[model samples]
Target: MGRVAGKVALVTGAGLGLGRASSLLLASEGARLVVSDIDEGLATHTAAEIVRGGGEALALRHDVSKPEDWSAAMAAIEQRFGRLDVLVNNAGIAIARNIEDTSLAEWRRTMAINLDGVFLGCQEGIKLMKKSGGGSIINLSSIDGVIGEADLAAYCASKGGVRTLTKAVAVHCAEQRYGIRCNSIHPGYIWTPQTENYLRDLGTLEQEKAKALSRHPIGFLGEPNDIAYMVLYLASDESKFVTGSEMVVDGGYLAV
Candidate 1:
């Protein structure tokens, strides 16, 4: 049997990138997936892929920053599966701007998706998970959450918020004996379509790749599967005791 066999999972921002990778991986491990994304087409396509692979999945158009969407998403999940077993809050936006260059609107938007989204997901996921006796909640953070970046003030703040919010949720669940575990996964420079766009904007994909590899002791940039594997582990019973922790999959970038 697969690691997460028979579980029900909801993954946000699952249209592409790390979120898509996580959804596919979880489904492969036998979890019935609810894949939601702002991009409806991508979400539907991903769900189709999962179904073709002999896994169960559903697609929903959802905007992670909105609480109404969260509520509706949960309601849909309940109607379809009757119970929720895992929630992966993986929707986020990255804006490369210094403190002075960042607009208030940009900052607020980032916080809404990256920080507020996690809070809402945890809150709703906990309520549903409690009914089922337990569940796993995984929040997607970044190396920026643990360290400082020159042009990523807002992104860093939002991720840092996620890191702390994850701990708070974990503590609350433990104190109330909810049998739920909450944790954050921090990744650094995983190559995704968005990252490709960033590299193209820089006009030097190879140079940027070289630079990213140089920072990591492993001498290679991480792939989407690298983060997906860690997420699957956290979602599975294999990480039963892992709560309120920050699992870094940074290719040793943080170690140095």
Candidate 2:
């Protein structure tokens, strides 16, 4: 139960879905949490839930795409918990569009949130994590990042950026002997609010969901906790030797 006990973890996009699940699980495992989301109310709600579950948590409104927001969030973390040991750069958005249909503005916006956000988080997180003698950085990529989707061009591009960026960060930290480990998580069609919205937009949620299910050789979609457990493992000292790796929790989706 105390897998991450005594650690300070910050999860961006902690308001809902995988972020919410990860926050709850990490808190239950005894990590003090900094729950940050663009939506202040959602972040507060998640934080309150953590506290109710007998965990320590602080909620803050943070826009991950903004450098100033990153500075403010780091400052707040320093003021509250003093150091951050685990960082989950989980804030992202999905735009369902083909390459030809995706406008430049749409591409820019996707990159800003999904790619740029993680970049900023890693950059800022490294500074504070170094102060605390090292930590783990978990960046959420997707199976689409490893493969391709005709309708998710921008999302694929952004997540692909995250996948590579994680490796780069891991290598740099290792070379500098900062004791920080960085890794990317590639998840399949997890049944989250994000996926729900994406499928709904594609018309006939049930049919789209079935199509998604058929793509996974495991025969079903994933739940939030499916990914949360992976987050827990990476956050714990058990993965001390693991770094710069791609952890795929895609229910055998890539196999087919």
Candidate 3:
């Protein structure tokens, strides 16, 4: 049997990048998924792809930053699946700006989507999971959250918030016996389409790729699968004893 057989998962930002990859991987491992994104078309496309691959999936246009949307999503899940087993808070944005240059609006927007969104997902997901025994909550953080970057101040702050928030949620769940486990996954420079766009905008993809690889001791940038592997481990029953931890999938970037 698959590792996550008979489980149900909700993946935010499932339209692309690591979220899309995680949604696909989880489904491949036999989990029915609720793939949600701000873009309805993309969410629908992702769900269709899973179903085409003979996996079960549902598409929802959900803005994770909104509490009402979270309620609606939980309601939909309850009506259809009856229980939620996993929640992947993978919706985030990176604003390229130094501390001095970062606007207040940009900072708030980053916090809203990156930090507030994850908070809402965890809060609502925990409530539903409590009803069904317990569940896993995975927050997608970044290496920027662990270390520092030149022009990603707001992004760093938002992700750092996620790191601590995961711990707090884990503690609360454990104390309350909510049966919910919370953890954060910090990824280094993964070559997703978003990063590709950044490289393309630099007008020197080869140079950017070389620079990114040079930072990693592994001599190569990570792929979406790297993060997905960790997500799978944390989402499965195999990680029953693991909670309130930060799993780094950085290809040794943080090691050096």
Tens digit of per-residue lDDT, candidate 1, span 168-231: 9999999999889999999989999877775565558888777767988988888999999999
* Clash list (residue pairs), candidate 2: none
Better of 1 and 2 by lDDT: 2
Write down the lDDT that model 1 would get: 0.91
* Winner by TM-score: 2
Residue 209 of model 3, lDDT score:
77
The runs of at least 3 residues in candidate 2 whose Cα sits more than 4 Å from the true structure, single-residue gaps closed, are: none
Q: TM-scores, in order shown?
A: 0.97, 0.99, 0.97
The TM-score between candidate 1 and the true structure equals: 0.97
What local lDDT does model 3 show for residue 56? 96
lDDT of 2 by residue, 1-256 (tens): 9999999999999999999999999999999999999999999999999999899999999999999999999999999989999999999999889999999999999999999999999999999999999999999999988999999999999999999999999999999999999999999999999999999988899999999999889888999999999999999999999999999999898886
Off by over 4 Å in 3: 200-203
Clash pairs detected, candidate 3: none
Model 1 residue pairs with clashes: none
